[model samples]
Target: MLLVRPPGVYRAQEDTSLLRQVLRRRGRRGLVEGRSVLDIGSGTGALGIEAFRAGAADLTAIDLSRRSVLTSWLNSRLHGIPATVRRGDLFSPVNPHRFDLVLANPPYVPTADRPPSRHRMARCWDAGPDGRVLLDRICAGAPSALDEDGTLLVVQSGIAGEQATLDRCEEAGLVAETVARARIPFGPVLRARVPELRTRGLLGPDQVEEELVVIEARHG
Candidate 1:
């Protein structure tokens, strides 16, 4: 089921596709019941909204974008759900090791150059020079932020070295596993680093592909 944006939210200005897919796959896995959920980098609060709908209690929606914080609040209000939307950099503002379930859809687009929109580049698309910057942080911090047996669900990219991300998680003592994956046509990462991928022997310069990988892992 798709979530309708709250009143005053600009329709068509939000991206809820990934959120829907995550919920669809994990919802059936029975992960959201009575948990204290944290939606990191929550844009428009879609992930947290679905978590709330799926039966999570005590939700927190966090984003770097001021606009997203406002929209998340609006969305929460629309759904009659109570979620705390806080503005911060990654998990910096949040208390450590305190979430039962943490969901992050961070910027996985590996870019050598940043985009014009600061919010888009920082919050939506740029992922360091190799796109693993934010992903690495999540992997590292997830262990501490998550409660014992807590799960960290992230939507990443194949173009961003999915195994490398898994390795990062494993290094952090989290057991990584792929929950779902889909091809996202002409995603921003594909457009940004075909040559770099080829140069690094990761891909052929002429080869262009679009793939999205979603991983659900638990901290040990």
Candidate 2:
């Protein structure tokens, strides 16, 4: 299998365990077959590329990282599929159009209390220090970008204030559920997350929880 890599200040590990769980639960219910799809923050285009394999005919992938856009284009070439990968801020380059499926995996690291240099995509990773910044934006903007009955899938950390994100989605007119959850070991970024969580009282001063909660949501 060709390795799938997302480029940026920080590249995601070469794994799709969480995404697979999403497919297992919501894939059949979503517009996977012969539908138009948009991937926001489409790092390396994993989810969108899978949508194509599942039968989505049109795909538009957007990411703020230029390296990510280039890598996505390369990955699409390797997959023998045509995808439009653009480098732009969220929804800036996209017109207000409805899509059968809209997917995103935003950076959900809260850094309000932590040092900034620890994260590469400081803007992407720091979501208002509670990690809900980008997630909230996506939830709020997704309904307008989705077609009637369109579904939006997003993955975030349990520590990223997952419940708050669900609530934000609901406020934005979408119903969300915890479709999947996984424990990802502390990576380079974990060093920073540990202290932040400790300060926030989410974890004991000496205890560090090494896991993230992933959720999938659908628009009504």
The sequence of per-residue lDDT tens digits that candidate 2 reaches over residues 1-220 is: 2645654433544224576456545547654777888888877677777778777888898988777788777887789879988888777788676788887878776676454343365655666667676788888888888888787777777777778878988898888877677776565665766776687765566554555666656765
Per-residue C-alpha lDDT of model 1 across residues 1-220, encoded as one tens digit per residue: 3445444332321134665567656667777778899999887677788888787888898877777778888778888888888998778878764888898887766666543236343346667667787888899888888888788888876777889888999999999988777765564546666677678775655666656777878965
TM-score of each: 0.83, 0.85
Worst 10 residues of 1 by lDDT: 7-16
Q: What RMSD, rounded to one decimal, does every model reach?
A: 3.7, 3.0
Error of 2 at 191 (Å): 2.4
The total number of steric clashes, by the backbone 3 Å criterion, in model 2 comes to 3
Query: Which runs in model 2 stand beyond 4 Å of their true positions?
Result: 4-10, 14-16, 24-31, 113-124, 204-207
User: In candidate 1, which residue ranges exceed 4 Å CA deviation?
Assistant: 1-19, 114-123, 192-202
The candidate maximizing lDDT is 1
**Cα-based lDDT for every prediction:** 0.74, 0.72
lDDT of 1 at 42: 80
